[model samples]
Target: MNIVSQEHQKSGQQPTEQVTYAAPYVDIEPAESGYVLRAEMPGVNRNGIQITVEDGNLVLVGQQQPLSVSGEALHRETRQLSYRRVYELDPSIDADRISARIDQGILTVNLQKAENLKPRRITLE
Candidate 1:
């Protein structure tokens, strides 16, 4: 997995765009038919997450918006930020059949193996 870093640019006294990024932890497990990938992305909503597979890479982007409260807080620990992680996909992966879902701050992706790559058992009579 690859972690993309935050980028900065300036143009003639314009306000600099401050970006805070974090890489969510991930786990990949192999199955008989495919692989299961799970990522921990706390504070990310449905609209705040994006998953895309392109150029033999699976990319995950998640964002956490700032909390909106009426009163000021005495202490603060959370910050609005974005999360990005990328994984290089092998030729055995069937990208067209890949599926993903998010629940309870966790993102799960099912990566199906290509037909020829799946294990097969042969019987001899």
Candidate 2:
């Protein structure tokens, strides 16, 4: 995850705090029974991520835990960051049956298609 901190400090201006968010890379695939959404959010743990489906939109929110450094670091690469991503879901999906899980910074959301909307074959006797 690329974390960018917004620090506005001028010669005589007071520093202001700004919050920025990074969007995680996501992959969506269609399956025989449903759709799968996989998001890659490095530095984010399971407890730091939140997922919800609201108003036909799948919302993902995540925050990286802050690192406690005892002394000044010679080199710095990572930062405290937050993440957010939203995807508009189709009405054919069964929202109630949706499932989500996270493993090794990978978040997977399974959206099951509505039973009535699934393709089926009819036998003609």
The most accurate candidate by lDDT is 2
Clashing pairs in 1: none
Model 2, residue pairs in steric clash: none
lDDT of 1: 0.79
Candidate 1 Cα deviation (angstroms), residue 123: 9.8
For candidate 2, the per-residue lDDT at 44 reads: 82
- Compose the digit string of candidate 2's lDDT tens values, residues 1-125: 54444324434556565668787888999977889989887778889988888888888888877766698889977545687787898999998998888888888889999999988998999
Per-residue lDDT, model 1, residue 51, is 83
Q: What lDDT does the true structure give each of the candidates?
A: 0.79, 0.80
Looking at model 1, which ten-residue stretch has the lowest summed lDDT?
Answer: 6-15
For model 2, give the 10-residue run with minimal summed lDDT. 2-11
